[model samples]
Target: MPAITVSRRQALLGTATVAAAAALSGLPPSRTLARAPFAAAQAPYYYRFAHGKMQATVVSDGILPLGDPSGTFLGTSKEEIGKMLTDNFLSTASVVLEQNILVLNTGDRLVLFDTGMGSSQLFGPTPGKMLANLKAAGIDPKDIDAVVATHAHCDHVWGIMSDDGSRNFPNAQIYISQADFDYWTDEAKLAIKEPAFMNAFIAGARKNLLPNRDRLVFVKDGQEFLPGIQAISAPGHTVGHTIYMITSDGKTLAAIGDLTHHQVLLLEKPRIEFAFDTDPKQSANTRVRILDMLAANRIPLIAYHFPWPGVGHVAKQGDGFRYYPTPLQMVLDQKG
Candidate 1:
């Protein structure tokens, strides 16, 4: 609930490490392209699955490889973190975070949740592929009925605008939590001095969000902005951070946004602190509570930063939890 202020040192220890690395190093964008770029005549980076009657598309925005987990993951040592990674059969030296953009078709309305990096070059050359992927998924940006954001973080909101800083989704109404809309748009607070890269976050948020003020709808907890989609107030990663629960025909899917960054470390050690969280203690508390409920209810989840097509279910394992990735099931294309 307090004012959000980020420093370069703090960012280095959080999710912003990639941004810090790209900015501080003054390095050039890598000649290497992100995997399966549509620009290179590759397979489309999207997976289509069904959540009850609604059709969901998980679009890829490429991956960001954060160099190390040392300071970024607090309350644990590098050796301990490395061991956890090895135990889970994951990479110990680096963390590869996925940027999954979810789209849903609820019969009448075409809804998009959380835009990807969108041509932003701040975190290296790996991101900014969401727009192309959306097209590959056979969805046009102008046809989107609603653009709902879980929060205003740079990676989540930057794609709302085009390269010329104009509204990208011209026909869509923008929706966000009232709390985050107030916090990120506070120009005075964002001016209090922080890392240069942090400033880009602030600027990017403003440019993308402010331009759509008239069309922006501020939502609250438990409010259903649409027919079957309701907002769940899950704060701490950022003030007013939220996740949407989509329910229909006796089935429910939780569109979890940034609740947990890593599949192994965060799920196994829910109490571990994250430097990127606006309120670490609160973030962990919310995470544990949500994970417990999801595991108990056996609800499937779509994680924003999990592996590609981040659809999975959680199970309680001792003092921790284990992720059971939902096996891909083919759904035939709808006939006209």
Candidate 2:
């Protein structure tokens, strides 16, 4: 056949005519297709990185959407703090904090640091997702050899029990600082008519820890929770809010649980007091001291409440501290 090609002008005119006909006939555009089904709401919440010979996995329990920081945050004006949040591209009206739970595989054993808010509704809907994330990370509750708690804060310890009040980690030993266990479980302290939340804390602790008391091993500062995990006393957030320093092959990473909540607000202003801290002065001192050590030694840390997978380093920035998140596979020269 001879060439039969439509000119550009003719093609454009034809497309316009078809569109006009469709529109006039109340029909949809030819390019418009039916709606697609909603895909999965979220992917698995887990991140894995190497800490020397050990493999560290961050299983997100989820986020806690907090109210305005003006009431909970101290040592700064609400206006300035709001500006700080804005500067960081975070929400000014509210802040969302991650509940990062760390799990380490040390060749011979699996260690979990902090069981997140189990089934508690105290913090709203976002939490209590730790178990699901853990499974998504290919770790079973029965495979966990030990559960080391930094503190007995509800967010950190409530996951020890199943909803039926049975031990969640059937084969694991539960480890926590004696000071915190005593402080939270004391009947006299619990009877002080504090906030209703404190009561919830006591009830949760009793429900979670007391059943596993036989398997509970109370640790003190400087004690080795495991062969490679040493507890560092970082008190004041709680009486015994100890930080777990994991070491192997001369490499060290610390799980600084609840040491600082917001990287910008708390880390940039380490002296800022959190209302949840038992002793605000002591908490601030511990924060500054630990941050100084981490910065000076160039050590990596996993903060429980920083952004997800909160693995990062603290550095001294003009008399204040800054959080430098360690990117995956980043290597630091020892001679640097």
Candidate 3:
């Protein structure tokens, strides 16, 4: 008989088959012979949920990592904040807030609430991914019917336009309180504020708001800005800082924009002021009032500055309130 002529491929195939069979038979398996590169990209950060008859999507605008909660949040001692953060198992060195932007589809119209930080690196470079995340959610900017800003802050209104000054949501009508619009964007107010900080805030506001002045719809408290979307004026964070009451088929969710910055720092100590608030005392009043109502009624809210996909409930605990983030519904329910 001729000597067996097994090619290198045949020999490798035979060895693989034996290893597979041995593994299936409960034998020890071979280890990986080569190294593999780790994953560099992340999955899409958008989360979608049922909103009564409509649909809601929470898209990541990345994160706003404010350095040192003690300085950014005041009306409380540094020691107090440090202890609170440590107790809660949160990072005590810095305060990181998620830019969880909300978008709604009311069948008749598509609405986007509070555009995230556009390209401004004033708070560092982590944020400004709203457009990318929005697209990842299968939403096209031109398809949005309304772009509502809870206030005129850079994190909220700056994303209205691209860096080149073109409308990011070209077809969508803009909605924002005239007070915030005028206050933040006014060149006159810039003179009084410290240029180091307020300059970019005002400049970004003007770059994103002034060009759309002719098309901007001034938001009125208690009025329905769009179908199923009502504006609720929750001031103090700014002159016209507002929160929105989104309702559909009897179900409602409060979109509290900057009403509270941190769950442990602000919510648990509702009176403690955030350094970013234009009027700390007034903001504390508003925070307590809105948080109190939400707690009593067990209403759910989406905090723009809360953890990612900030859909949760607030409950009165001890002297203040406690936040409970709802477990995300990764799959569609029977209704969907």
The most accurate candidate by TM-score is 3
**Residue 231, model 1, lDDT:** 94
Weakest 10 consecutive residues of candidate 1 by summed lDDT: 1-10
Better of 1 and 3 by lDDT: 3
lDDT order of candidates, top first: 3, 2, 1
Tell me the deviation in Å of residue 89 in model 3.
0.4
Model 2 misplacement above 4 A: 1-38, 329-336
List, residue by residue over 54-130, the lDDT tens digit for candidate 3.
Answer: 88999988999898888788887999999999999999998999998999988999999999989888788899899
TM per candidate? 0.85, 0.87, 0.90
Arrange candidates by TM-score, highest first: which order? 3, 2, 1
lDDT of 2: 0.87
RMSD of each predicted structure:
18.0, 6.6, 6.6
Kindly list the per-residue Cα lDDT of model 2 for residues 47-109, writing each as its tens digit: 888777888899998988778888788877988898878888988888788999999999899
Q: Per-residue CA lDDT of candidate 1, range 1-336, in tens?
A: 233444655665764666566667785434243586457466668999877788889888888676688757888888899999998788878788899888999999999999988887776899988888888888898999999999998889988999786777899999899899888877876675654445666777888999899999988899988999999999999998999999977799999998998888899998888777878999999999999999999999999988888999999998888989987776454421
lDDT of 3 at 138: 94
Top candidate by lDDT: 3
The window of 10 residues in a row where model 3 has the poorest summed lDDT is 1-10
